[model samples]
Target: MQVLLASPRGFCAGVNMAIDSLELALKAFGAPIYVYHEIVHNRHVVEHFQERGVVFLEELEEAPTGSTLLFSAHGVSPEVRQKAKERDLRAIDATCPLVTKVHLEAIKYAKEGRTIVLIGHEGHDEVIGTMGEAPEAILLVESPEDVDALEIAHPEHMAYLTQTTLSVDDTSRIIARLRERFPLIAGPTKSDICYATQNRQEAVAKLSADADLTLVLGSQNSSNSQRLAELSKEHGVAAYLIDGPQDLKPEWFEGVETVLVTAGASAPETVVEAVLDYLKEHYDAKIEPRLVREENVSFPLPRELRQLASS
Candidate 1:
């Protein structure tokens, strides 16, 4: 068996920043640190932090009052921030700037009385946060059918934004449907889908063409990882989204000759290498990295962390 690895697969700038924020917070403030959610969507990353005394909470209420609290990379709604403030918890925001940009757009468009259409998965943390920016003004649309059923007060005065981690092809189709239904719909001058998501998906699409099976290393709750698996399936290839090599099944590769391996933006490359090492030992596989794109993006740690480090 041969393993084809996808290039540009694993930790994006946002994930990198989010993870660093937590580590720096731990270093500066000491342990028992509370993170509002998984800093990034990778299980190994979250577990690593858990082992280091970082507490992951699903709600603000879970955080002890007056404790240092950090928001995850997925961003949080205004309500969550308000609750944090009410509780007097020290807060550090680690939201990806790109996600914050979409939230700002939702706010601006809503203030202008434009009905905002959000293109994203309905329950995704990012979507929930973005929608909360202008819930009254925003409607979530997951597909063309949802767009068709959408009823807005004024179609002419409307705009759209998307979650940062959507599939490029799926988003384009939904955007096209929105444009067709409302010829004057306004949207981002550029795509809302982040560059990391686009590059990773493109890499998977390119690699899945000739591979016998595709394995995506990521958590089940990760939207981007799920999308990579879906992209592979779209190409008529067998694909599985696994958190790590432990989730791998020997039967999955029973008749497979070539396997394509990729990881979500939040996934660690070491996990992928571990999976590859397992495959090499078990299946006598040869590995080749399939480069589709090169990424040079890097995001700095939060201002507070930077100051503390410099101090």
Candidate 2:
């Protein structure tokens, strides 16, 4: 068996910054540090932090008064921030800057009296956060069909935004359908999908074309990982999004000569290596790195952490 590894896979700048912020917080403040959600969507990453005494909560009230809290990389709405403030909790925001950009765009468009059409899966953390920015003004749509079904109160005054982690190809198709339906719809000055998501999807699309099978290392809740798997199948290749080697089944390798391995932006490289090690032990897999592009993007730590360090 031959294994093709995708370059620029695993741990994007946003994820790195989020995780590093948590680590530093833990070191400085000690255990029982509360995070609003999984620091990232990867199960392994979350579990590792949980073992280290990081508490993951879905509700703000669950946190003790005056306790330190870290927001997930997915970002949160202004209401969440206000609620945290009401509770007097010390908070560190770990939202990806790109996601924050979309939120800001939402605020700008809504302030302009434009009904916002958000292109993303409904209820996704990032989508929810972006929508919450202008809930009264934002209408959520997941597909071209959804766009067709939309009946806006003000068609003449509308704009569109998207989840930061979405399939680049699918989002483009949706955008086209949206423009066709609402000929005057305005979009962001720049794309809402972040650079890491676009680059990873492109790399996987190319790899899937040549490889017989593609394995994406990420959790089911991970939006970008799901897109990578879907894109592979779209290219007429079989793909699986697995958390780690534990999820791998021997049946997947049957009659497969070339396998492409890639990881989502939030996934750790260690998980990818574990999968590779499993294949090596079971199938004597020969590994070859398939570099489609080079990624050097880096994001700074949360402002609170930076200030703490400087102080």
Candidate 3:
């Protein structure tokens, strides 16, 4: 079997910044760091931090007063920040700058009294947070069909925003539908989808077209990871979203000549390497590096955390 490895896969700048911030918090502060949610949506990444005494909480009230709390990369609502202040907890924001940009755009459009159409999966952490910015003003739409179903309060005054991690092609279709219905809809100055998500999806889409199968290394709850797997299937290849090699089944590889292995933005590269090792041992797979694009993006740590490190 031949293994086609997708370059620009696994940890992106946002994930790297989030993980690094958490690690520095551990060293600067002590164990038992209270994080609002999993720093990033990878099982392996969360488990590794849990072993180091990080506590993941779903609500601000769950954390003890005065404890240090960090927001996950999937930025939190302003209400969450206010609650943290009320609880007297030291808060460190680990939100990706790209996600933050969407939040800001939501605030901007809401203040303009425009009916904001937010394109994202319902109940997703990032979507939830972005909606919280203007619950009264924002309407969540997931599909092009949903866009058709929208009943804008004022057709002439409307804007749209999207979750940073979304299928570029799907989002474009949804946006087209929105424009078809509301020809006057406004949008952000640039696309809301981050560069890393676009690059990884493009790599997998290109590789999966030629490979017999595609294995996406990520957890089930990971939205971007799920999209990568879905994107592969859309490209006419069978794809599986697996956390690690342990999830791999021999039966799936039957009659497969080549496999495309890629990882999501939040997935650790070590998991990818482990999957490669398994493929080599079981199928004697020969690996080939397939590069669709080059990614060289980096984000700075949250200012509070940086000061903590310096202090």
List TM-scores for all candidates, in order: 0.98, 0.98, 0.99
Ranking by lDDT: 3, 2, 1
Model 1 residue 272 CA deviation (Å) reads 0.5
Q: Which stretches of candidate 1 lie over 4 Å from their true place?
A: none
* Residue 85 displacement (Å), model 2: 0.4
Model 3 per-residue lDDT tens digits across residues 1-311 = 99999999999999999999999999988999999988999999999999999999997899999999999999999999999999999999999999999999999999999999999999899999999999999999999889888877689999999998999999999999999999999999899999999999999877887898999999999999999999999999999999999999999999999999999999999999999999999999999999899988999999998776677
lDDT tens readout by residue for model 2, 175-216: 999999999999988898999999999998888888999999
Overall local distance difference test of candidate 3: 0.94
Best candidate per lDDT, number?
3
lDDT over C-alpha atoms for residue 139 of model 1: 90
Error of 3 at 82 (Å): 0.1
> Distance from true position, residue 17, model 1, in Å?
0.4
Per-candidate local distance difference test: 0.92, 0.93, 0.94
